[model samples]
Target: MPTGLLILLYLVAALLPLGLAWAQGLTPRPLVDELASGAGILALTVILAEFLLLGRYRFVARRLGTDIVMRMHQLLARGAAILALVHPFLYTTRRAPAPDWDSHRQFFVTADFSALWPGIIAWLLLPALVLMAIGRSTLGFRYETWRMLHGLGAALIAGFAVLHALRAGRYSADPAMSIVWLALLGIALFALAYVYVLTPLVQLRRPWRVSAVTPVALKTWEVSLRPARNFPFRYHAGQFAWLNIGTNPFGLWENPFSISSAPSAGPELRFLIKELGDFTDTIGQIKPGCRAYLDGPHGHLSVTGHSAPGIALIAGGVGIAPMLATLRELHARNDPRPTALIYGNRTEEQIACRAELESIASEHGTRLTHVLSAPPKDWHGATGMVSPDLLRAHFSDPEHKRWLYVLCGPAPMLEAVEDALIELGIPSRNILSERFSYD
Candidate 1:
């Protein structure tokens, strides 16, 4: 779906509870109490919808990009936490319910312990959940363990929040409002089921085997995979997949890596991975014929549908993985459009597939620039970072403004390059970028 339409749908979903409550036509409570109720309702609905963002639903990720999806998940979770944390304190209602008021429009808060405990549990856990996510790396937990904890923790919060909503909320007393909360809860549960159960079951039938693991650059390896049988997986050139090497499809040992080979390069898949600790350190140990599984083909960092007159690719370190896929795809298609690549690395030894890149550039008339931060004596190539000055020198041409710019790299480089492109009059929509890390 188009991003604007998807955003519209999200807005509709978020506000649906408030709309339903308004339709109840109950006597208006004090402004403070009504604001508290609004906050709680929005918090509940948004928390439930947050699960769908990470459910591996291609529909959401394909349009918004996985990086965008993850950022949304984080921001929305924090917002929900703030609202939930302040929900109880905002209410001006009396401790005991107003005896004469209708059950669905009580002017006083309920003091019943059973009805309040679920919200209390959710309220207490929400902050911890957000804090754990924010401090995931600092806590020094394994990626797999942290991922498992985050999923279960969010589910626990959702369950208790829903329970509190149905049992204690004034708007939820109506059958119509109760049905809405139940449906949202069902959707949240289904998102979890789809990711953990149904997706893995399907992946079991079409497995992969490691074909090659060759050192491509300093601290980086190019891992290749071939289907165990005749597998039929198709993805865009600049997309990525979560690889579960020698692990079950349902396990949490998977890590996402961009497909470094072109889709046009037959069925074999390649990933250019740099050892950055964790599971990546084991890349050199995996022998050929090791069992593997994939759970992706995600992200929206491709030039497939653009109509730009030229293409510009900016990559740093292993970020070149996806750009290489795109470059190879363009070569396979025998495209005649002008292309330029700005690849940056700390040392010359860290440049991946140098020969292949040169061959492509020579044959396809691509302009390839290699920037090194630490060049050896007598080095001739550009010696510096992929800075804004360097970008302006290469891409300041009038015609280049209409080009489609693709970026993949560490967060800092991506930010700098993207800002430079936009500052140089390139339309923001013409720039496509995918981050290599998510927390």
Candidate 2:
């Protein structure tokens, strides 16, 4: 689906409960009371919808881009937390038992402890959950441990919020609104199950084995995976996948990596991994033939349908993984479009696949520019960071602005290059980029 249509559907689904509540035509309360109720309802619905934005669904992630989806997840979680925190405080109506003539409690908030306690608990936990997620890396927990905690915490919050709404909400007293709350809760739980249970079950049937592991550069290794059977893994160039090596398919040890091999190369998948974290630091020790699993083909970095007359690939350090895939795929298809690659690293030793990059440039008529920030004394190529000045020197032509520019790298480099490209008159939509760090 197009991104705009997906957004429209999301808004309609999220606001459906609020619309139903408004249709009930209940007695009017103070403006503050109405605001409180509306806030709570919207927050609950947004929280429920967050499960689908976690980037596990290909229909959403592939179409909108995984980075955008994950970004939406983070922002929506924070927004819901704020709304949930202030929901009860905004109420000015009295919380007391309904009088004899008001047995339905249409004019006052519920005073029942059972119904109120769940709301209190969920309200208190929501902020803590958001804080933990924002500070996950600094809290001394492993990525897998933090991921599991985040998932479980979100599930608990959703359950508590639903219980509070069904028991204490005045509008939820209506049968239709009650059913809406229950349906939303059920959908949230099913999303969790689909990601954690069903996806792993499907992966079990198409397992892969590590076929080779070779050192490609300083602290970098190229790992290859071949299917245990005749399973075919279909993916576009410049996309990524979550890789689980030598572990249970359902385990939480997976990490995302861009596929370094072109899809046209074969069914076997290859990844260029740099040693950075705990799992990555031990990658070189992984033995061939170990079981592996891949959940992927995510991201929107490919240039498949682009109409640009040329392509420009800008990569920094290990970010070249996806760029390699793009270049190889273009070569395999014998594409006639002009191509240029500007790859930068701290030193020459850190450059991975140097020989292959040279071969591709020679064979495919690509203009390859290598930049080293800390070059040896005898080094002769560009010897500074990939700054705007360097970009202007290479891509100053007006025609260059019309060419598609794809970038992947550290956060700072990606930001700098993206800004420079826009300043150079390249349309933002024509400049595709993927950042390794979501934060």
Candidate 3:
């Protein structure tokens, strides 16, 4: 829908200028006019979609509809580059009393380097951005580093494009065009400054404190935090937050961890993290009194409005954090919604919050089932992976497909479960799954 609206707007902008020129008898060559207008529109559309809309660096991007937003920006940026190279040529060729070949060569290749410098910088920025984005993981660039470079690149490209358009004087000759350009640029600039500058600075002022850290598994730990003041923003179950560590208010080193403790379960927030890289390994060493900053309460995998006769939750590994929070939230609400949870781990040791989960389930009239893939000898709980057969054997109405199925687990397990549900003729909307890409 957004793509289609963008294309329609592009066509409108492209044709309006050409229509005015034609009516005023400015150009006799129809083909040249059409080509110039089309290229100009394509360039503007790309500018609007890429740097202006989706690429305005924000903390929410990491948790929001990030994948789709990023893909849109990449596609539009490439398209803009192609249009930037074509528009000037078409416009110059169609001008009245066309200049000599040498005159054309001078303007295209040599004249007014000051006016052209910004465009040159934009061209360089494009490929650099593409390289960084594509090679982000392969090049070992951390999220914060990529984010900083990404912001700088976007700002340069946008600033250059705005200057280039005004200097060329072709698109901004009219009042309407000038106003539109300014409005678009203003919006983009505001969003960029707000997200990259203002928000982080505000967070830096009211820093949180790390109160406790306990090892949950070989590579996983539970972190406890308290705000400098009592937080008014109440969080729902299964929501996550972006934790900014070190002196990095620049958004270069932030990680999203689901709140393992329910808001009702405690005054402080708890995050269950697995040591995947440089950040998590040193997280446990963070002093209890050290100030921290958090931006959170995101994700919508909660138990709100999900009132079926029965509920089923499936978690794998650290994914159990959100499910545990959900159960706690339900317990707090005094929701007598009969709920069953199936938690999976590689071994019994990897299962986080086992006792806590069992206690919560028992206290709240819920059922907790543990599923281990590689349990040691003398293990008694449901062994092997949480497969379709396992679910069928354990639950009375596994195939009924009427109960609410909220799944938080590894992608592979979620994929398998989704496939299993489809195989059992369940509607796609009936199943809700959360796939965390924290790694």
TM-score of 1: 0.96
Alpha-carbon error at 223 in model 2, in Å? 0.6
Candidate 1 lDDT by residue in tens digits, 261-318:
9999999999998998889999999999999999888888889888899999999999
Worst 10 residues of 2 by lDDT: 98-107
Estimate candidate 3's alpha-carbon lDDT, on a 0 to 1 scale.
Answer: 0.69
Once model 1 is optimally superposed onto the true structure by TM-score, how far is the C-alpha of residue 184 displaced, in angstroms?
0.6
What candidate 3 gets wrong by more than 4 Å, as runs, is 1-40, 43-47, 50-116, 168-173, 246-251, 365-400, 434-439
lDDT order, best first, reads 2, 1, 3
**Model 1, C-alpha of 282: deviation from truth (Å):** 0.6
Provide the lDDT at 100 for model 3. Answer: 64
- Residue 160 error, candidate 3, Å: 2.0
TM-score quality measure for candidate 3: 0.77
| TM-score of every candidate | 0.96, 0.96, 0.77
> What's the candidate order when arranged by decreasing TM-score?
1, 2, 3
* lDDT digits (tens) for residues 142-260 of candidate 2: 88888898899899999999999999998887899999999989999999999899888989998999999999999999999999989778899999999999998899999999999
lDDT of 3 by residue, 123-193 (tens): 56766776677678789987767778888887777778667655543435455656666766776777677
Colliding pairs, model 1: none
